[model samples]
Target: MSVIIKAAPLELMIIGGAALGAYIIANPMKVIKAGFKMSIKAMTAKGPQKQDYVELLQMMFQLFQAFRKEGPQGIEKHIEEPDKSDIFKAYPSFMHNHHAVHFLCDTMKITLSAEMSPYDVDDLLDADIKAIHHEEHMAVHAVQTVADGFPGLGIVAAVLGIVKTMAHLTDGVEKIGALVASALVGTMLGVFGAYGLIGPTATKMGADIDAEGRYLGCIKAAMVALQRGAPPIVCVEYARRSIMPEERPSFEEVDKATKEIKKAA
Candidate 1:
């Protein structure tokens, strides 16, 4: 590794510098920051875990129950200021997610007002979900753009290496061979960086973003079901079914959970 670096130091600088400059030019500060955060999250998190999905369903069930038992007026306090509400506070993980919280509260606000049709509410939620993810998609796209440029940048590094070698034709055969080897390392680095590192990271980021959107989609499913006057159990089932199969709670599990919630209430 050190030998490769020593041989290709100039190649490294040119490729690395050009890539960084392009990334900086291509993305705004917000996108650059989002890219960094998304990469970190993709590395650390496996998207929404099974337990996370279960907890989300549980929270929605409780909220719907509150609305059913006490009427819209009774549930008003919880949605109006979720931070202060005991129901939301109980699920610390869900509370920490600002998008989920706002999505729940905003939709509930509209529902309590009794203004929109259930289908209209569904459409509104779909639009909101798309709008929220659009920025995240841009961040992933920026990283993919960088990955796509890497192989070409590697060629650029190799060409520069050859240019430098050309200026040293008077050197011995041993020196010329070393220069050629260094040039080849630049190409290797570029291709390897693209396929092995940045490309894979971008793909992972895209998956994570999709997983997050699906989590929100579950909330939308439940909220729309509620608007349609489904019972709390059916509302939660709508949400539960929206979850990916692996992460989804079983029907018996959801049934048992709602029962426990009722017992507690």
Candidate 2:
């Protein structure tokens, strides 16, 4: 039992370090550290909220509405200087996320460039969002791969322990019991690593990535609808409704936000 308690935690550090050290030796330490940091962030960041997205859609609606009523010239005031844009300035968190910022700005720029169908722009932007997510997925995949291998290597550790115990097969009953117990520890460690820690963490990161995908999709829908010349209220509605139902706001919630946006503008 003592063997079980002591070796179990070490199984992760030992197996994980081995896998990571192998990978790190092949990749640059800087890149590995960045991947490590993102993995940690993935673990911590609870992800965007229903409220965050609702506000985002509200702000997007305000922006799109102004464009429809005032034309591209209307948004130029805000886009040229988003820091001062009364709408964007209000949602500083959304503004600070570079990916979200670039996604919003690039789509608007494409729309402003000429007579482009918003639907086509929406499809292209969706593709872009997918590409960004796919790249992030690679990092996720690597960490998961390491996690997957840990349990198997832990079994290998257990097997080695059993082999060591066999060499003492003649040590009599008490020693044999201790040896057998120690050998079984490796197996316990393997199973624990598989189910308790690494697997859950990998699954969590995947969920995080999936949630982020939805948020970006919301951005795409709102901007595309705006490009198609929808009302700001209607465009925001498009964005808000695109959210997965769990993350979606009530119609009344969106309505209130849209109303306030209008009152403010």
Candidate 3:
């Protein structure tokens, strides 16, 4: 079966152009930029991969150990300027993530101050995670909004097609039927765009956002455990257990890696 619809382009343009304009109107420049980036990244990535989570946990374990051995002063340099720090440099994947770096460093900065109680630290980290997720959710909401409007936009396209078809009524039944079919293509395109493309993407973006939040949550769990005076290894274990099972490293694997980190130190 040959596949082609001549009027699809024009109909799609009407629906797509209006949807894009509405998206711009509904969101700020920052969100638009983030949405674009998130959509592109989602095509290749499904949130934090297994290796990413492994590196994250390893980095946290190492950082905690440094704090244990050298105290606040020794750990200060790494937390303050992580880009220049040798410790952070060792884990390129974790270091490359600005969010993870900032989250780890900032929390360490507060912990080293020796002011906040364990409860207080937990509360602070919880608040920060919530705030970060809230900002990220805005981009997801923007995409979902466009998806929700797509069906109506399709209907608008179909209606416009019908109007054009009306002007050509004297062109004979065969001609009128072709024009009506072209008009119906608009509805098909709109629904397809909404459900087939934009809707699924929005859902994936939301999942990515949630995954990143859970990554941060793992760090928070470890930090809180550290504040409670748990041993460094135990603290990291706490963090590791917080990870989604699929991403969580095996107990033996983490134990062996932590031992190697200690050996190298």
Candidate 4:
């Protein structure tokens, strides 16, 4: 314990400093910023939850109903300035997700302003999803790369400890042993950091990224259905089906919620 206490700081400095330097070198400025931001988010951000999806589905249904009844002009005010739209403001959780808001609003704008078939809309939304996924995953990849290098960095720390131990061999058996033991702490820290901490963090970030992508995919499914002239309820059902089972609101739940929304309208 004493040896670890004495040696841990230097070992951590070496491993942490090298890892930070490597991360900076490997990633662009944008990705570096994003990686740090995402790492913080991974710890606190609960991706999209069941209630978030419920709000999202409800919002979409309302938007579709408006468009169906009154056409493009009806939705123009809402889509153009979503931050100020009463429909958007009503669903705070859905509106809070800036990426989701832009994705939905931007796609709707294009669909309304241009002559696009369902296939073209699908292609466009696919391209948007891919672009967002690629951007977010780059940060995840950067973090994973650092996690992978931690073990090797630990070995480096251990070797440095070994080198220090060699010089103290003449001091005494107790002193030499202490130095050797302290050096091993570096190895332990490295392995623990890689597997027990940093690696798992990277994995969490990746999972969150996938969850966000699925959220966007849900929007895509409904948007395509809307283009095909599906009714508002059917369009939202298409979206609800696209959600992962764990987070999907039940069909009855959604139906009841939409009925309530209609009553409010």
Candidate 5:
């Protein structure tokens, strides 16, 4: 069947404009701006990828090897002086991210200082990461809510079209058909906004959240293994395998890297 191409930008403007006006009236510009910023971040900044996992393992292996060579005292110097640590300098992305930096360093520092049980420390720190991500979830909820309302809002747009059509009842059948068709476009816009834009955005945000969650889980796996006194090779493996398959490196890759560290030692 041939497609009927319809141009109804003005009609969409009427409906979408009214919806946006209402949102503006309900929310302050600052709150709206913040929401906008969050939306942009969600769209632009994806979660850590597979290479990030590989880098993390590489870093952990190096650090663990350092600890093995010079004992806790050597690792302590890095923790105490992260700015001076060549290890921290190696991964600019991890180093630049204050959250990631603090998460990694704080756990190891506590292990050194609190004399904490590695498993207990891992559990407590995992809880902390969950709480942090939970707070970020408000952004996800905001997007999903926008999606849910879009279809109904489109119906609202359609009603305005009908109201316009009713005003011109004396018009010919041709005019009425045009009016009805124009009105349905609002409904169409709503469904389109809901499914095509907002719904997909929500799904993407969820995936991003899951990816970040896996990153934190890697930290947990490594820290737990270290606490349990596993060798550096085994400890990094726990972290490496914690990664999702789409991003996980081969075992041989990790093993070869671990061997390189041993060789360097």
Candidate 6:
């Protein structure tokens, strides 16, 4: 216990400091900032829950209804400044997701302003989704790289401890044993950090990134359906089908939600 207590700070400083330095060296400033932000988000953010998706579909249904009823101009005000739009403001959960908001609004803007076919819209949304995924995953990759290096960094700490131990060999067996034990702490910490903490955190961040991507994909599906002239409810149904079954709201649930919106309208 004494050996570990004495050795832990230095061991952590060595492993953690080196790992952070390596991360900074490997990524650009944007990615470095994003990695830090994403790491924090991984710990705190819940990603998109089922209710969030329900809100998303409901929001889209309302927007599509406006577009269908009053034409492109009817929906323009809402898409142009969603924060001020009563329709957007009604779904606070959907509004809070900036990525989804921009994804849906930007596609709608292009579709309304231009004459792109559904195929072109699909390609455009695909490219946008891929770009976002790539940018976000860069941070995930950075974190995973740091996680992968932890074990190796721990080994380096152990070797430093061993070197320190060599100098104390002439002191006494007890002292030498303590020094050696202290040295081994580095290896233990590194392996534990890599496998027990950092690695899992990176995996979580990756999963969250994927979840966000899926959310955007849902929007893309709806947008494409809208371009193809599917009804408001049908557009959201297309989005619902794109969701993973585990998180998907049922058809009846979506149908009922849209009905309520119609009633409110």
Query: Mind sharing the TM-score for model 4?
Result: 0.97
Candidates' C-alpha lDDT: 0.89, 0.76, 0.87, 0.93, 0.76, 0.92
Q: Please, what are the lDDT tens digits per residue for candidate 2 over residues 127-168?
A: 998888877776676667766777777777767677778888
lDDT of 6 at 186: 99
Top candidate, metric lDDT = 4
What is the TM-score of each predicted model, taking all chains together? 0.93, 0.85, 0.95, 0.97, 0.81, 0.97
User: How many steric overlaps are in each model, in order?
Assistant: 0, 0, 0, 0, 0, 0
lDDT of 5 by residue, 133-197 (tens): 77556656656767787788888878888999998899989889888887888788789888997
Superposition error at 230 for model 5 (Å): 2.2
The local lDDT score (0 to 100) that residue 75 gets in candidate 3 is 88
lDDT winner between candidates 2 and 3: 3
List the pairs of residues colliding in candidate 5: none
- Give stretches of model 3 more than 4 Å off: 1-4
Tell me the lDDT of candidate 3.
Answer: 0.87
RMSD of 5: 3.7
Candidate 6 residue-wise lDDT, 95-213, digit = tens: 88888889888888888888999999999999998999899899989999999999999999999999988888789998998888999999999999999988888899999989999
- Candidate 4, residue 157: Cα displacement in angstroms equals 1.1
Tens-digit lDDT track for model 1 on 1-265? 7659795667768777898889989999999999988888878878778888878888999989888999988789999999999999988879988899999999999877768888999999999999989999999999999989988999999888899899888998988988888998889888988999889999999998788899999999998899899999899999998888988889888888788888999
